[model samples]
Target: MAEKPAWLKPHGRPWTRGPGRVVFENPWIEVTEFDAVAPTGRPAHYGLVGFKNHAIAVLPIHDDGCVTLVGQNRLPFADYSWEIPEGGGPLAVDPLDGARRELAEETGLEADHWREVLQAQLSNSVTDELAFGFIATGLRQAAGGHQMDATEDLAIARPPFREALRAALDGHLKDVLTLAMLLRAYHMAREGALPAALARAMLG
Candidate 1:
């Protein structure tokens, strides 16, 4: 059985949500305002952002340990963002399948091996955006080419895994999904969970 820290346990009282009304909604997200009771026994109003699809991220690591990344301009942040391949999976679909499609779409790559490395609740306080991150090894170019959205303008990069991880740690690559996936992949490499040769390539 897997072990967990003794100190690990849920803390504090749970918030009780009462009636809620949808404040805004679109194909991608819905905002709802709710009547709620805080953990501290206080009544409060809470606003929640609900996502209609699961977020999926893929770290496509080549045999040489180069991690494929995609760059695009983001309107919300008003900046160019470089990140691993990411996309939304329908709630009813397997997230790993979504990750594979995203990898092919954004980077025109596919993998012979896939491992689910991370699961995250993007923002528990405000959003219920669940994300799944994967490490895709044994990479190769997809013969079908990419299938990006018509509106997407993306730049691709093949950077050493260590360098990409460093940029994420140094705050240069600001995508949270990319950062989280890279950190998890690093841990996997160091902990011997990954193939030794591949791990060596990643770490060195």
Candidate 2:
């Protein structure tokens, strides 16, 4: 088991007074306090926000050693670019299901094998979202086809690992979460710790 860090402790009771947000809106995790004192004896809040959301990302490596990616227009970025298929939020069950669903919905591919690689809380001090990074292998093309939201226009692409990494580093691929997962996957593949197909994908 992983050891807990020294700063770990059960959350103290919320400091806010009375019930909030329940009467007028959907139920959400409320963060009463986001600022904290660090070892440097300085205060940092990292621009605290009230809630955390959960999301997932999929890196599909094919038999021919090419990583599956998507090029799409992002309203935030205001451009067409490359990124791994990812999304899921406010679900009723474990987020892994959402991860799998997003992969199939966005990329038209299914994996016979999937593993949870990491659980990351983005902007931990503020926001209330946990992003789960998953490693998927043994990919097979889907028959039912992709089911992306109409507003989300996506074109699938298969790029060799080096090329993909280069694109990521060069700003062609702009999603921070996708870049993080791919580089971590690359390191795992390099160490012979990832699926054989993933390794092959990186090489070819």
Candidate 3:
């Protein structure tokens, strides 16, 4: 086999940043406008939104090949969306804890096992929003029912993994985090990153 190429190192040049001013501020995000010199030495003004929290999402797969999904009205799109359990966690806190809480709050399901599956920047050019994805298995109902937020009127669904994957591929599930995580789970099943039985159940 040919030797793998060595990892590349960063160029390590910092952009020349000018003073930045806040354009808008809310509880969840802050938009700032700044002047900067780009790597190509062009003067530019940039507007970026910074999130107050990191996004967390959990994919809860039960032993029976079913996954939990939550449905709610999303304000930005003014449409109802079905997605895997997701929430925001303060940047200073552990994201895994946020995943656990969101899973319980949205679906009243608790997982006995948890694994961090993916991390990605969400729209890096527009917002400094980071996301964490987790795989949760060995699920059971919480002692009490869902503890949803006051603003949330969520509907819960438990569907076979294959059905959910189809919906995601068909664009019925538009949430970026949900799409990414579900595809990651499928990749895991195909690549043998998951247990044989569990992978079979998920892919089937």
**Which one is best on TM-score?**
1
lDDT of 3 by residue, 30-82 (tens): 99999998888889999989999999999999887889999999999899999
Preferred candidate (lDDT higher): 1 or 2: 1
Highest lDDT among the candidates is held by which one?
Answer: 1
Put down candidate 1 lDDT per residue, 1-204, tens digits, no spaces: 378888998799999999999999999999999999999999999999999999999999988988999999999989999999998999999998999999999999989999998889998989999999999999988999898999899999999999999999999999999999899989988999999999999898
Model 1, which residues run further than 4 Å from truth?
1-4
- What order do candidates take by TM-score, descending? 1, 3, 2
Q: Compared with the true structure, what per-residue lDDT tens digits does model 2 show for residues 113-174?
A: 88877677776655557788887778887787798887788888888778888888887777
Q: What's the number of clashes in each of the models?
A: 0, 6, 0
Which window of ten consecutive residues has the lowest lDDT sum in model 2?
A: 17-26
Kindly report which residue stretches of model 3 are placed more than 4 angstroms away from their true locations once superposed.
1-14
Score every model by TM-score. 0.96, 0.75, 0.93
Lowest-lDDT window of 10 residues in candidate 3? 1-10
The per-residue C-alpha lDDT of model 1 at residue 185 equals 88
Q: What lDDT does the true structure give each of the candidates?
A: 0.94, 0.73, 0.93
- Cα RMSDs of all predictions? 1.2, 4.9, 2.8
Candidates ranked by lDDT: 1, 3, 2
How many clashing residue pairs, candidate 3? 0
